[model samples]
Target: AQTVTQSQPEMSVQEAETVTLSCTYDTSESDYYLFWYKQPPSRQMILVIRQEAYKQQNATENRFSVNFQKAAKSFSLKISDSQLGDAAMYFCAYSKDSNYQLIWGAGTKLIIKP
Candidate 1:
């Protein structure tokens, strides 16, 4: 079984600043997948970035990037140049493979301190 945990319940950052949200996971498999999803007030799940367990380089997508530590089982999301629109609940997810279900973290509510 795999589980993800987000230690930060809520985080705030000024517009244009950067913020890093912490996440850790427990998995037995050597190869798996990690993902960061953003859910705004609309409640729609949006994939911010994804990292393959075998990949050594961190995954990045524009303002979103992940610091994936395979040995530590930690995958943290870094949001750069944060915007007001970025305010939402971010979730850390893990999956063994395509056929498996995604294990989700509790969630981190992001607030923009405009």
Candidate 2:
């Protein structure tokens, strides 16, 4: 069984600063996809970033990026210059195919301090 774990239940960062949310997963498959999703107050799941296990390079989108360590089974999200809008529940997920079915982690609520 594949599972994702987020050690931090909550994280805080000052506006204009950077914050990293830690996530780890256990999987037997060699090839898989990892994703970071953010759900704001409106309850909309937004794709932050994604990483392919077979790829050596990390994935990034705008101020969002991921440190994907396939060997360690760790995928952490880094949000640069975080704004008030970045305050949301961030979830880490693992999938074998596309975003159809995903094994998700206990999300971390991000607090942005002004």
Candidate 3:
């Protein structure tokens, strides 16, 4: 069974700064996919970023990025220039393959300090 874990239950960041949320997973498959999803107060799941296990370079999207360590089975999300809009619950997920079902972490509640 593949399992994703987010050690931090909650996190806070000042507007215009940066923050990184930690995540780890245990999986038997060597090749898989990782994803970070953000759910705002609206409760809509949005894909923040994704990483393919075979890729050596971490994925980046504007101010968001990931640190993927395949050997350690760790994948973390980094949000730069954080904004109030970024305050939300972030979940780390894993999938055996692109089309397979996802394994989700509990989530980390992110609060933006005004």
After superposition on all C-alphas, the RMSD of every candidate to the true structure, in Å, is 0.7, 1.2, 0.7
Q: What is the lDDT of residue 53 in candidate 1?
A: 96
For model 2, residues 1-114, the per-residue Cα lDDT tens digits are 889999999999999999999999998888999999999999999988888888999998999999999889999999999999999999999998775489999999999999
Clashing pairs in 2: none
TM-score ranking, high to low:
3, 1, 2
Error of 3 at 29 (Å): 1.1
Model 2: weakest 10-residue lDDT segment is: 94-103
> How many times do residue backbones clash in model 3?
0
Q: Is candidate 1 or candidate 2 better by lDDT?
A: 1
Whole-model alpha-carbon lDDT for candidate 2:
0.95
lDDT of 3 at 81: 96
Can you tell me which runs of candidate 1 are displaced by over 4 Å? none
**Residue by residue across 1-114, what tens digits does model 1's lDDT show?**
678999999999999999999999998999999999999999998999999999999999999999999999999999999999999999999999877899999999999999
Better TM-score candidate (1, 2) = 1
Stretches off by above 4 angstroms in model 3 are none
Alpha carbon deviation, residue 25, candidate 2 (Å) = 0.1
